[model samples]
Target: MAGVGLMVLLLTGCGTLQRGVDMARGAVFGPKGVRPAPEEVAASPYAQLLIEDDAVSAVMLLGNDDDGRTAWFTDQHVVFLCEGDLVCGTHGLSARLDDMRIVGPNPFVDLRAIGQAPFTVDRRYDWHDGYRYGVQVTGTVRRVGEEEVEILERKRTLVRYEEQLSGGVDGKNIYWIDPATGQLRKSRQLVAPGHYAEIEILKPYRRRVQ
Candidate 1:
């Protein structure tokens, strides 16, 4: 009886010792060369918008929400991610910027260069409810002087510009542009009739390193 008890105790101790050795080995080498398969990356349109040397990527929070969404922009266009699953591209706004004659040390826009008379722009966007519609706005640009604005928690003095729009929608839009590079720092854009969104630049334009 005594010999059997001694044998059981020795076997139990050996079992515990083997468990400890296995745990130590796992910590050191993690299962002896077994590695997890790499996860497959999903393709995204927002990612495609970011092209080397062609566009810059940015992030902005929509409306008063806390969720951040990705955006990509070039000198000619800006694309935004809507609700994490939708992509909204606005080309009309970019066209307006391209049409303006920005000059001088202040890099101010000459509204007259947009044309002596008001011009109309039509934009189409798909709504969350699975419906597409056109928003028409007629507007002319004007300089609104320098103003202090906060972007990404940093205060910046930027040249302010205003667009007075009418037609299908009637509203005034504002933009704060960096005079040094003609980059838009902040904007309150009229998205739809009776609807608007405020956009603040969280990051400046920079080339992505491959």
Candidate 2:
């Protein structure tokens, strides 16, 4: 986690965490001009996050949530709250998914057991646009079968799912889940209409038994 300290320092030197992350995009990570190797990513427990292609490295905050939610932060400012690899809330994005509630069965919780294809789950969400809050939407998720994908040079098969939302927001939430670990390797989720987030879990967060 030595690199994490340097990343934090860069963010602290800059004004806001958001701005620091933006500046560090070119200054901190640009020297490489390419993605790091798999071994380097696996060396530290960090996840790579991207909101609309702008990339940033995130540190997972240790938690003991009974519901299995994990928190991730970038420069200790921007936050991404996840219910088992599925994003439930976000902060510091231009537009954000303020809150999300899975109404019935949480399909994301069980990647390996969703039987055949075309399964469904009910969900609701609170969104934050450039405007104000109180924006609510509901949606249904559908299983989209397994897909072969490569991440940082490693190839694997991942189960796919999508959320088609309506009633206030109109967009789709997509995910690629690793059946073995039940972790989302990649996801493209709609934060708000015209705004979405893409996250790649370069290195997954595993809590060290303390």
Q: How do all models score by TM-score?
A: 0.42, 0.67
lDDT of 1 by residue, 1-210 (tens): 343343234323323212222221222111322222212112211222111111222222121111323333332233343322122433223212111111222212222233234433333333332233344445556676789986434578897878776764578767677766666656766554455545554433332335
Candidate 2 per-residue lDDT, tens place, 65-96, comes to 32345444543334444565666766555566
- Cα lDDT computed for each candidate against the true fold: 0.39, 0.58
Model 1 scores worst on lDDT over the 10 consecutive residues at 94-103
| Best TM-score among the predictions, by candidate number | 2
Segments of candidate 2 deviating more than 4 angstroms: 1-34, 45-67, 130-136, 207-210
Q: What is the TM-score (0 to 1) of candidate 2? A: 0.67
Question: RMSD to native for every prediction?
Answer: 22.8, 6.9
**With candidate 1 superimposed using the best TM-score fit, by how many Å does residue 112's alpha carbon deviate from the native?**
12
